[model samples]
Target: EAGVAQSPRYKIIEKRQSVAFWCNPISGHATLYWYQQILGQGPKLLIQFQNNGVVDDSQLPKDRFSAERLKGVDSTLKIQPAKLEDSAVYLCASSLEGGYGYTFGSGTRLTVV
Candidate 1:
């Protein structure tokens, strides 16, 4: 099976800048999740989506972070007016509905200066 695809493996931007990361999950997966992993920390869930609808976004920082899944296939996460604390690896994962096995993308690393 093809793995999840993510774009722009790395990015660097000054504080208050904006950046977006793209993700294409494995075909046929119905659940998707976005995570943020800071240095020396495990990935933290940012958002969860089932199909084209949001299942959970409580952990997402609405003021600066936003994400969406279009037509339940492709997804994008954007951070606007980023802060120094926003530096981390953004990960996208997908799994079958109600399944625990998730397939993850390589992720996009963001650096805020």
Candidate 2:
């Protein structure tokens, strides 16, 4: 199976700066998710999409974080005016709808100085 693809595996930005991460999920997968993993902490669900429609975003910080899956394929996540606490790895994952297995991308690491 082709793995999910993410770009710019690492990033560093001063506080209040903005950054964006891109993700391309495996083909045929209908569900996609974005997660935030703080250092030494388990990944937290940021958002989830079924096709082009959002299934869940209750954990997303809409004030500064936003995401979209374009036409139900590739996706992007953006964080504006990043805070020091936002430093972490942003991961993208995808799976078949209602499937148990999830394939995850390598992730983009953000450091807010």
Residues 1-113, model 1: lDDT tens digits: 89999998999999999999999999999999999999999999999999999999999999999999989998999999999999999999999974498999999999999
Q: lDDT of all predictions, in order shown?
A: 0.95, 0.94
- RMSD in order of candidates: 0.8, 0.8
Per-candidate TM-scores read 0.97, 0.97
Expressed as tens digits, the lDDT of each residue in 1-113 for candidate 2 is 79999987999999999999999999999999999999999999999999999999999999999999979999999999899999999999999964469899999999999
Positional deviation of 78 in candidate 1, in angstroms? 0.3
In terms of lDDT, the poorest run of 10 residues in model 1 is 95-104
Q: Over 4 Å off in model 2, which ranges?
A: none
> How badly does each model clash, as a count of residue pairs?
0, 0
Question: What residue pairs clash in candidate 1, if any at all?
Answer: none
